[model samples]
Target: MPATPAWPPKSAPRLFVADVLSAGLAVRIEGNPAHYLARVMRVAPGDVVILCDDVTGEWAARVSDVGKRDVVVEIAELLRPREAVPDLWLCPALLKKDRFDLILEKATELGTARIQPLITRRCVADKLNLERARAITTEAAEQCARTALPELNEPVKLDALLAGWPEDRALFFADENGGEPAAQAFAASKGSPAAILTGPEGGFDDAERAAIRAHPQARPITLGPRILRGETAAIAALAAWMAISGDW
Candidate 1:
């Protein structure tokens, strides 16, 4: 006989829902998610769909009803518990809209525990749409098969951010002027509460740099010899950190 098909097949569409999922619970998905399932994916009754409630983790659900504007699925079984993300946070200076969006999406995929947008003297953009930002992260998480979502934070001025900096957490500053190598510094500080701070396109102003360096928790780190754009630095630094100190 042929081998049995896998539960929650790999091809099944994945989504993040607001409801706390439990076995046998009937979940009513509406709005955009419903449209995606019923119209885009063409899911019908008996179809298996992967659902994740940021709180309870991932589950296998069987489609029970489908309507023009909604899709209902009954939770079947838990696939995986919510994952424990690294304690590292990405504190990147807000760049242009598209650039910042890339940072948010990639950061979620790389598994940063939190994202704290910074407003520096040289930053071209200082505002973020939390709703749109959350949607980008949610979609990225679903695409990456992540069971938990990263904590998205509002943008704060550089001074305000530093003022409230936690004493226990290390802040790795990506300085264009140069400092300790990123890989080496990250390796030495593994398994600690940490955050990476990358500057904007124009880079941090002298006073801003001084202020950051003067912080007790700051550790200036260099990405490499070449200069990187705001978005590139944030993404590169995050990837390196994840491989060195974060869960890879």
Candidate 2:
């Protein structure tokens, strides 16, 4: 006989729901998500739909009802528990709208525990739409099949962020002027709670840089010899840290 098909087939349409999923729970997906499932994916009764609640975990659900503006799925069984992401945060100075959006999407895909946007003297953009930002992260998480979403915090001024910095978490500053190599620094602080801070377009002003360096938990690190753009630095630093110290 042929081998049995896998439960929650890989081709199933995955979605992150707002409800706390449980066995036999009926989930009603509405609005945009409903349109994607009902019209885009054209899911019908008995079709398999993968759901994640962020709080609980991943689950296998079967479509029980379909409507013009909604689709209901009955949770079948839990596939896996919410993943344990690294205790790493990405604190990047606000860049342009499109650039910062990239940072948010890539950070979520790379498994950042939290994203703390910073407002520095050199920052071109100081405001972030939390709702839209959260949407970007949520979409990225779904595309990457991540069970848990990254904590997206509102943009805070650089000084305020430094003042309220946690005592235990190490803050790795991506200083363009130069400092310790990123790989070496990350390796040394492996298995510790850490956060990487990258500057904005023109980089941090002199006073801001000095203040950051003066922080007790701050460790200035260099990406390489060449200077990187705001978005590039954040993404590069995160990728390198994940490869070296993260759960990769």
**lDDT (tens digit, per residue) of candidate 1 on 143-205:** 999999999999999999999999999999999999999999999999999999999989999
Q: For all candidates, what are the clash counts?
A: 0, 0
Provide the overall lDDT of each model, using Cα atoms, as 2-decimal numbers: 0.95, 0.96
Per residue, candidate 2 scores C-alpha lDDT tens digits across 1-248 of 99999877888999999999999999999999999999988999999999999998999999999999899999999999999999999999999999999999999999999999999998998799999999999999999999999999999998899999999999999999999999999999999999999999999899999999999999999999998999999999999999999999
* Model 2 stretches with alpha carbons more than 4 Å out: 1-3
Per-residue error for 156 in candidate 1, Å, reads 0.4
- Where does model 1 exceed 4 Å of error? none
Clash pairs for candidate 2: none
